[model samples]
Target: MGSNAPLNVSAMVVNSLESSGIDHVFLVPGKLIYPLLDAIDNSPLIRGIVGAHETGSAFMADGYARASRKFGVCAGISGPGTMNFVPGMAAAHADRIPMLYIAGGISSHAEGKGAFQDATPGGIFESGVVRSLVTDIVELKNKENTQAEMRRAIEGLNWMRRAQSFISIPVDVQKQDVLPGQEVARQPYAHGEFNACEVPANRAALDALCDQYLFQSKRVAFLVGSRGNDAETAKLLLEVAEGFHIPVATTLSGKGAFPEQHALALGVYGFSSHSRAARVINSDELDVLVVFGSDLNQRDSMNWSRRLTGGKELFIFDDSFDSPAMGHISRQGIFSGISASFRLLAQKAADNPPGLPQALQRRKGWIAEINETPLYDHRFEQLGDRVSSGDEALYPGDVVKHLCRILPKDSNVVVDSGAHRIFMAHYWLSSGKGNYFSSSSLAPMGWAIAAGIGVKLAAPERPCVVVTGDGCMMMHGMEIQTAARYRVKVIYVVLNNAAHGAIHIDAIRSGSISEQFTKLPCHSWSAFASSIGVAARVVERIDELDGVLSEACQYDGPFLIEVITGVFPAPNRYYAEAEACP
Candidate 1:
């Protein structure tokens, strides 16, 4: 609970946010938001994080929620400031991150008039925010009405499924006084407080299905996704897989849900996937596929080809049964939370004990087959001899491999969109949940640095690394100053190829030899970082990379490592196929 003494509307809003358990508010301050900013500065429960851009603040909020599994809050002024949140809010919507967006509005009396920074008819933000409210402070003269409106706005924070709430407070009304009044009626269900809406599993029905699929099926596979990637749910998923002798695979968004080093772990399955997982998924021996918390999107399903789930029977356990992914698949869908559903299934397996001596033997055979398969041939490892022969410069793949080997197992890696993302997706081996973070659905550029800052804030003790491209760094490079200002330690690895490598490859595949606007002038990233008071280094050769990274990792503040790599096409089989077509 916040202070109950006499306060203004701005203080009331801040109190409500703090009461809802928001620990930080990312914002870009403006003249209209002075009162709110002052209230936030004075509040002990919430800290204000000032970002270089509104989009960066929104992305930071998104990252905070993704990493901590708690509600995130961000604020901006009206008009252009509010418009700046569109891209980041859209990304959050696509990925199902919870956020609260606060915007300072023009005075109510000036509505429809040409006032400065006026964005009237507030519907401009409706598409981005799931729920919104525009209330004038003067309309609520007493504390009772003001508290009711605030409570109504707070109710929208309860849903975590890509839920974003917007609140627009008029400037004139923000300074109005709010006297003590009766408490508003609390809702029976509050966001992040009650789990009454959590769907429960029917034990009898689940057991019967397991008997048919788990015991009788010749080959069973388990696929987990971001929705069920929590530590507790992951533990139970592993237990059930081990008990039933089932091999497990994960979507790219769900990478690290299952330990990549485990024998049954099949790595990521889909675009740029591990070869063994792809082979197992496309094999004819598989009879049943169990999906937990995956949306089965085109990317997750490798463009939804029949090779993955053509003849197999599907069992999908998700919180929402109306998911569009279930439309085409032949599946018996269980609408339940991942944790509750897995617990019941694990209990049923323990009681029934599907006694099959062949299960372990089959599991061992699959592991052996995957180990012997040359599914993922590391192109960088092949090019190592060439680099030593002075034929080729270092590639992004080489950098990723060295990072995986040198960085601590508990370190968190946040990757931005570009050729580098594909390299890290296929090569970076994650050992635990929350160890990897990315925006695969939105694939927004400039997301890594801001999101990495938020991750560092949420888990201050862990080392957070950001892998981005030159284009991405240029988009939000100013955020490095934000990191330095907060003294948040983050290792930023910039793969500088002096162009949008993915787009360049696309152009080359399209038969255009001359890259027109894709090429960019090389900028000294180390000098730019140093100007912002961040320690930085430039690594031009492969031999210098490991040592530079080691020294950068030991520094106590923000650090940047710009790896000067040559322009090369992204290592994706799909690109090769596209180039071969026609």
Candidate 2:
């Protein structure tokens, strides 16, 4: 009854995590997990943070890894519980965060024998997790190998560090026993090694390509990706852009990587990207397009493939790169380690002086032209006017921009998935490296609320904000209570559009506004916020936005503000419609 039973598999798993420096595990209890839960209850080295749902647990772990640069663990029951985490796991995998997923599994002998909740736990998580393995490490027959299996799990967890990995332990094995190890030493996995992209080979060949573009082209551009929280890389890319007098555009993920307000900063160039950035990409101003760490996914790529015509295009990326099955847009592809590529570019710039002054001047002119370009109609701005006056009623975009202005130079911003991401990318500015985070690949809802809590927990001193749409707010609204219980001081700003604004707008554009069942009736978001034991306010007008945000920032604990916003077609959708007409 004391669970002093010889080394339970669950105890070994917890010991392994403890050795690997994982101090916290997020979990939701279920009957299948009783054995493992029993082990967790007994472990002194690890603590379990009970989450409201499986997805919340997974998101919490994902955020912990993203912020702390270490592995976070999540545990759940098999079948339905594990299935609930698929979206969060997908986001973790796509975004490359280190997280371990532990799920309680049915006995191997009883599996598929019509046992209750007899799903193939590993198979269900195969696509979502980097790897899925089931172990019977506590088998009495293999008492000596219990520690070995634990070590293997830690190694496997390391592989999932940037991707979600699953360790499934059969209930019977977890309840059974094996001889405990003589001593519990910390298990070591891969040490500090750069998992970033490897630099491309054929440097001489690339130098020839760069020389040709430098001598022949009138305009060139550096399309930077998220530099993995490396501001030095950002500065180096900016220097290269300045050396060639070419504009630098960024992906949404690339927003904070380059200070967008800079004169040479072209703007975000994706589906919801700025008009000026789109114009530059659309125009003949591009002679050589250099891309870095770009996923080139639908949202980031503006739903259109880059057509390589008279000009040449180059891509430098890490693991997030997605090569289209149709074809590639690049004349030459470079997978250089990010730092190595930067070094090479620096040397290349130093060696070749291709009218640097003239190029720099030409780039300045291009920047000026971009600054003068008009933007999309401000429908949200008009909506803010319909509510209240002053800062309390600022549009979600304005609210985020203002936060950027006041946020400490070192604070990080993590956004959940929704239409609100468009606003954050377009307006928010980061002062230094590692300033922003979001899930663009899977774009799952309910991520930001839990993720913000995890981020705050990981870096309590650093203020974090979760800017999410009402739809997203609805998905994870309850998690605010979790934040309150944990004393997380993250600010939550909900862009309330009265409906599923993004989806509604998409439906309206396609001539089917009536089918927007995704939209919700106007709800008392502030009242709901108050129920979570956090301060809450609702801004119906534009002018009230600033004061509320200021107070929220100063609040001692978690806070929420629901700002009414109007939905409009995103930039890429506008273009797609125009193309459809012709």
Candidate 3:
């Protein structure tokens, strides 16, 4: 009974997180997890951030993971608290984010005894997480067994890259003792310590495919996705496009994958897409299409339009050969990393030059045609010009465009789901990798505020700006207090449109006259932010936008700028086209 124990099970768990390079832990405090909280508070290598809600905690972890390119950790209590994590975990799962979810369970003896908050752990998150483990109290009591289980959980996380892993510790087990010098073991995979893996490309096979399809084709295009949207991949893509006279288009999630300002870049494709990109992707003249990293989902592919890929010879480069996102159009699918595949292809092109003067001239013609033609509707163009003067209420697109010009090139922009997201997606220019973050697959509202806080915590030096709608902000506005508490310098740009803008737009598109239900009562978001000790401002005119944004950017702490924008239509011609078709 008097034996010397080096640490407790809770301490061992914390040690494992530290070894995995996780520096921040987002959690909601609970009595069941007091021991774990105490351990985290005592650890020098990790810091604990309390969230306003369990859902926010999970989203915060997701933000940290996406921004830092490291695994994020979030913990909560049993039952309701665990259930709150379902939506956020599902968002991470759908978007392929790595998150470590920890939860407290009822005492081992309370099993089948109708104990308080006695729901089964990990049951709610089974669909969202890759693996879930419920630790046995008896196993935790033994030092060797504890180490083995910890290693097993971490190994599962490492193997299942970009997926969530769940582990639940019973209240009784968390207090168990660990023997001296019983540290968790590290198992490094060939793909380094994290999810960034490089698969060797088959140079010969790639060259043959490129010569047959790319070099000989009359029209070729590249569709890039979030997976291969990094700077290294982007640079290689530009070279391939320029060398072979191809145009590049990206998914909404991959908006910043290629520089939008480049002449060869066609901007985003699918759902609320740029007119030029959609026209090129749907053109019958495009004989060859090379897709990289994107899943080619309905949102990104416009319900998998036959016009977009039916006649073209599709070449897909993804991490897995059996990706469900590839659809049925790919004639050739390569199971290789996007960067590695492109690198080999780029090298082969250099070795065997294909001098296609006609193709180059055609590509130049296409660019000039797009530049001369109006991309957006005439009504939207007029609104954009009027909003620039700040004489009337601000438009979401104008706000995003101004922010793009004002913020530093390296600023990390996190956008929440709403009609505003479409505006931001179309207008925000991303110059670097990981500079823009949004959850398009799941499209969860209120994600940006919490996720922005996590992004700031991960990259303290970089400016993290959150663009959210009024309705979206109200859902998780309390998280602003969490940011203030941690001194997270995130500028909250609240587009205060007094309605569920997306729902209103949907109703209008459906020819419904009764959209009053979507309207919301206006609130003073600036006053709310100031009450929470954050620097706040209300921007009523376009003239005030620049000065307010500049001041918020310069502020050393949390800041909120509420811009009163009336409900307006997004530049979404795809919705209209889909409605009219069939």
- Best-performing candidate as measured by TM-score: 1
Among these predictions, the greatest lDDT belongs to 3
Residue 165's C-alpha lDDT in candidate 1?
A: 64
lDDT of 2 by residue, 1-582 (tens): 233546766677677677777777889998878878888888887767888888988888888776766777888877787787777777876666666778777776785567776656334433233333221111122435556655554553442224345666667777766664433454335664454323343466457646666544456766666543444566666666555656777777777666666666767776566766676775665666766667565555666444322244544444333343324443445545555566666677777665655655666676677777644345423343322223533356665666677667667688876667776776676553655777666668888888887777777877788888778777877888887886779888888877676677656656565744846877888898898698998876756777888899899888898887766433344335434542
Error of 2 at 179 (Å): 5.2
lDDT, residue 84, candidate 1: 84
Better of 1 and 3 by TM-score: 1
Instruction: Determine which window of 10 residues in candidate 3 has minimal summed lDDT.
Output: 130-139
- Candidate 2 vs candidate 3: the TM-score winner is 3
Give the lDDT of residue 161 in candidate 1: 43
Error of 1 at 141 (Å): 11
Worst 10 residues of 2 by lDDT: 132-141
Clashing pairs in 3: 390-542
Q: What is the lDDT of residue 233 in candidate 1?
A: 72
Candidates 2 and 3 compared by lDDT, better number: 3
Each prediction's whole-model lDDT (CA): 0.75, 0.66, 0.76
lDDT (tens digit, per residue) of candidate 1 on 341-393: 77887776666555445555676676677667544756433344221113456
